[model samples]
Target: MPVRDILQLGHPLLRAVAEPVADPSAPAIANLVTDLTDTVAHWRDTTGYGRAIAAPQIGELQRVILLRLPGRPVWPLINPSIIAHSPEKLVVWDACLSFLSIFMQVERYEWIRVRYQDQQGQWHEAHAGREDDLAELLQHEIDHLDGILSLDRMVDVKSLCSREEFERQFKANSPYGR
Candidate 1:
């Protein structure tokens, strides 16, 4: 699998909702998962940042996302959907591969239940809560499938900050900090 180009912010395609994958077992989807895995891996290796990526970020208008948190195996979520979520919310700084240079403060559910198919086409429901990073990550990736960006969820204009400023001023307090 080769690393594909990541569509940057302001790309028209980034705003387009992705189509649901009709057959998770299809060869095309397999290739797409591989490409997403490779692409995200490359990004994490080069930039020291990146936890996951969605198909739309690569110009593939399909509801697919790849995630590989530290110490976890890389995997793809096919046609993922958030089935339930807590009313409680947590505000955190969020960034995207499409707009790597900007970070914004966005509110996300403290917990979420997701339904999705694995690469092998098996259906599964997973839950993540405030204690787990997946709560935010799953929300972020699923938003991509719906053509929503972190920019759309920003709390306010003042919440927006450049990556450099984020690192210098906020990284020290971030749970996601290095």
Candidate 2:
């Protein structure tokens, strides 16, 4: 599978809620999971910063996301939902594969409880906290499924900056982690 073109901020598809997958085991969905995983991997290899990506980012109107976390397997979450979130919030300089040239400072939940399914159609749930990168990543990608962007959740619109300016002014706020 090839890396699909990631839609930009203004694209109408990005604003539309993705439809839930009816059959997680279907070949089409399986292929989408593969494409998404490959795309994020390709992004990390090229830009050196990527953790998760949603199907909508690639112009696919499906409720699916692929996550690649450190010390874990690369997996796809079908119809993922945030069942719970902590009251605490963290200021994060969030970026997306869809908009690689920009970054935004947005407040995200310090932790979240999520329910999702694997490609095999197995359901799983977990609590992802700030102890790892999943907290920020989950919020970002889940937002994509609901047609929300980091720009929408930004605590400070002035926090928006291009990659160059972000690197120069807020290098310490790098969202990337090992």
Candidate 3:
């Protein structure tokens, strides 16, 4: 599979809710996972950021996302949803492959439990908490599947800043920088 172009922040498709994958093991879904993996890898290499990407980011209207933690292989989540989440919220800075130039501070669950299907169509549930980063990362990608962006989750209007500004003015205080 080839790396597909990512839909930018203003693309209408980015705002449209993605459809659920009818068959997790379908050939097309497998190919989509490959493309998402390849695309996110390429972006991460180029920008030194981007840990995951959603199908909708590549203009595919499907509820799918590929996550690649540092020094780890790509993991695909099909028809993923947050089955439960902690009542506690954490404020975190988020950036997206679709709009890497901007960084926003958003509030996400401190812990989450997600249910999803693997490429083999096997169902599984995973839990993530603050230390793992997956708590917010999964929330971010899942939001894309629902036509939401980090900008939509902004803690405050003042929380939006350019990447350069974030680095210059706030990196030292950011968890990502620490």
Candidate 4:
């Protein structure tokens, strides 16, 4: 298990669409999945907030994602693709580990259906609806598989904020704050 270095914006690899995992049983792919899981877990333990991560963000050109839901075991999705999406949309603030400082508001489907493979090379499909951050996180990571970054999805570049600034603004705008 390893914590891979995250590729940053402007890296050509981040813009290239990832290739589908041809052999899920490959030892290298399996090792990557383990590394991704460890990386996500390490981030969550240190910062208390990561829920999902993508392969491109780690410099890998593979359609892989690792998700760890609260109270649930780590879920590995190999060759994940969004097969369906709802017309209804929602704007949410998101931050990427690759772009650690920037937070952006990107629009995403309120519901989505995705098809993917598990660690054991078995196929599976799942539906996610306005069910908390899981759906949003899933879409965010899947976008990475397709070479799409949250910055590209931003409605306005000016709306982007640094993590510190976002926290300050949120506090200032909160009702409890004088």
Q: Model 1 misses residue 83 by how many Å?
A: 0.5
Instruction: After the best TM-score superposition of candidate 1, give how far the Cα of residue 105 lies from its true spot, in angstroms.
Output: 0.2
Residue lDDT tens for model 4, 1-178: 7788778888999889999999898999989988898888887778655778898878889989998777888888998888999999988777788787777888888889999998778999999886656678899899898888888888778879887887777524421122
Cα error of candidate 3 at position 6, Å: 0.7
lDDT for model 4, please: 0.82
TM-score of each: 0.97, 0.94, 0.95, 0.90
lDDT of 3 at 113: 98
- In order, the Cα lDDT scores of the candidates are 0.91, 0.87, 0.90, 0.82
* Least well predicted 10-residue stretch by lDDT in candidate 1: 169-178
Tens digits of per-residue lDDT, candidate 1, 9-31, equal 99999999999888999999999
Steric clashes per prediction: 0, 0, 0, 0
Which structure among the candidates has the greatest TM-score?
1
- Model 1 TM-score relative to the real fold: 0.97
Compared with the true structure, what per-residue lDDT tens digits does model 3 show for residues 83-163? 999999999999888898999899999999999999988999999897648899999999999999999999998888999
Model 4: pairs clashing at backbone N, Cα or C within 3 Å: none
